[model samples]
Target: MTTILVTGGTGTLGRHVVERLRQDGGNEVRVLSRSSRPYAVDLRKGGAELDAAVAGVDTIVHCASSPGGGDEQAARNLVAAARRAGVRHLVYISIVGVDRVPLGYYQAKLAVERQIEESGLGWTVLRATQFHDLLVRLFQAMAKLPVMLVPAGVSDQPVDASEVAARLAELALAAPAGRVEDLGGPEVRPLDDLARSYLRATARRRPLIRVPLAGKAYRGFRSGGHLAPEHRVGKGTFDDDLAARFS
Candidate 1:
């Protein structure tokens, strides 16, 4: 059986990946988190504990990420520790348009991708569109205000986290393939419309205003750089996610 370690296995996407892997049965799965026992190791810190967490692990699915920053440093630490442990494969989940989008988080993800590719280890990187949970969180924060202000001309293809998790599990079980095809949601829709839909679903009425922001990152989003129309492999829709969440 392949011994696999999953970083941030308690997180939104990581938990799904762990569940699918466990449900498949046969592999020895381990989760590395600050709160997990024995294997608990913070990816952002390179130390003996992190090294121990990677020992004897054949593959690692790196799902731990921080939008507040420090992801690049975390990747560096993980790569070094994995190398020391003689890990055979490293699987990573990244966001689509990480290279195209100028956001700091995207840039950090892209940097991590580069580190993985050049680490001399067999690696598989899967870049997917934004997840439905992310969108929901965004809308939830926006709804807190009396008036919802959204970015103008911005569209998103929000994929299901479960589907993405299944894909990641499959990849972890297969031979390493460097940089597979991008995965996207079933459809792309404007952010404003989605916000309105969120309001309707939550039974909250709020005035929506679209404000155009001037910036490279905003422009990247407005131009749909994050979209993968050709690889709309995800079958779940935003409405479906809303129904499951709000209902």
Candidate 2:
């Protein structure tokens, strides 16, 4: 049996990946956690434990990232560990508009992408749209404001995290096929509309005001840089998800 290893196995999406492999897939699974008892070994620090943990792994579902955490060291560590372990297939989850946007997170993701590309390992990179929960998290911190500030004329097509998780699992099971098509939600909506929906769900009444933001990230979004117009995943609508969240 091919033992699939999932990095950031305790994260929102990584948790789903591990569950699907163990519960739905019935595959031999190994999860890379910062602190898995019995101490699975620190891949970041690089040692005998890291080598031992990944020794027999056949595939890697790399849902790992350093967003708000690591700059690029996390990915480099994972790649080095995977190479030393001799993994066969490596599936990476990335953002849909990362190539077009100029955010620090995107740059970090790009660094990881390049590392995987040159590694000569059987690798697949799947780019997905922004997750609903990501939006919720962003709004949860700012929804309390009397007025929600958004980038004027920018748009988004937020997809469900669960759906993205499912797709990543699918990729983990399949052969590594270069860069897959972009995956997104059913409908595209303005940032203002998304903020409004978020406020409504949280029982807050706030006005959404759009203002011009200065940055390549803002410009990229304003120029349809975020929406994958051709790659609609159609798994969940934001409105439906809102209801489910409140229900």
Candidate 3:
């Protein structure tokens, strides 16, 4: 049986990945996290805990990340530990448009991708679009204001986190395929439309204001730099997700 370690196993995407891996059977799965849950190991600190997690693991699905900050250091530490343990494969989960988008978080993800590439270990990097639940949460936060401000000309192909997790599990079991095809949602929808849908689903009425943003990040999104139209591999749509959650 192949031994696999999954960092951020408690997270949204990581949780799904772990669930799928366990369902597949015939594999020993370990979860790396700060909590004292079963098979949990702290990966932020590259000491004995990290080493113990990496040691004897045939493959590592690296889903642990801090998009706001500290992602690069976390990846670096993990890569170092993997190398020390002589890991056979290291799979990393990254966001779509990390290279094209000008956001600081995207920049951090891109930096980690580069670190993994340079690590000289067998690796695969899968770049997926924003999760449907994340977009819902974004709209929920925006709904707090009297007037919901939506970024004009911005579009997203929000994929299901569970679908991404299944794909990651498939890649982890297979041989390392460096930088595979990008994974995207079933449809590309405007952010404003998504917000309107959310408001309608929740039966909340609010004045929607479309504000044209002026920044490199906004321009990138407006220009469809974050979209992968040809890679619409996901079967779930935002509307379907909303209907399941709210209907």
Candidate 4:
């Protein structure tokens, strides 16, 4: 049986990946998280526990990440341990436009991608557009105000988290293919429109306004650098997720 370890296995995307692998059967799927027992290890400060977790593992699906900070250090720690354990395959899930987007989190993700490529292990990196769940949380926070403000001219192609997890599981079971095609939702919609949809879904009325921001990052967003229009492989849309969530 192929021994696969999923880092951040209890998280949003990681949990689904773990479930899909288990449902497929025949593979020994292990979870490595700070909270998961028997293998609770923090990649940021990896030590004996992390080494133990990577030991004898054939493939590792790295899904652990922190948007606030410290992702680069975590990637470094994981790479070192994986190399020592002689891991054969390393699969990573990243956001679209990590290279073009100037956001700090995007930069950190790009750094992690480089770390994996140079680690001498068989590796695959898949970049996907923003998840619908992320958008929901963002809108939920923004909707607290009397007027919802969004970045002007910024659009997002939000894909379902489950779909992304499905793709990750498929890749983990196969040989390393290097960087694959980008994945995105069926349609690219503006943030204002999506916020309006969220309001409608929640049955709440709020005034929505688009505020133009200044920054290369905001400009990149306006120019659609974070979008993958040609690779619209995702079927579920933001509205689809909102309906399922609110209904």
After superposition, candidate 4 runs with Cα above 4 Å error: none
Q: lDDT by residue for model 2 over 92-162, one digit each (tens)?
A: 99887778888888877877888889888999998888888888888777766777777789778988877
Model 2 clash pairs?
none
lDDT value, residue 106 of candidate 4: 96
lDDT of 4 by residue, 19-128 (tens): 99999999999999999999999899999999999999999999999999989999999989999999999999999999998999999999999999998999999999
Residues 60-102 of candidate 1 have per-residue lDDT tens digits of 9999999999999999999999899999999999999999989
Clashing pairs in 1: none
Please estimate how well model 1 matches the true structure, expressed as its whole-model Cα lDDT: 0.93
lDDT of 3: 0.91
Q: Of the candidates numbered 1 and 3, which has the greater lDDT value?
A: 1
Count clashing residue pairs in model 2: 0
Put down candidate 3 lDDT per residue, 1-247, tens digits, no spaces. Answer: 9999999998989989999999999999998877846556656567877887788999999998776688888898999999999999999999889989899999999999999999999999999999998999999999999899999888989999999999999999999999999999999988888898899988899998899989899999999988999999999999889999999
Where does model 1 exceed 4 Å of error?
none
lDDT for each of the candidates? 0.93, 0.80, 0.91, 0.94
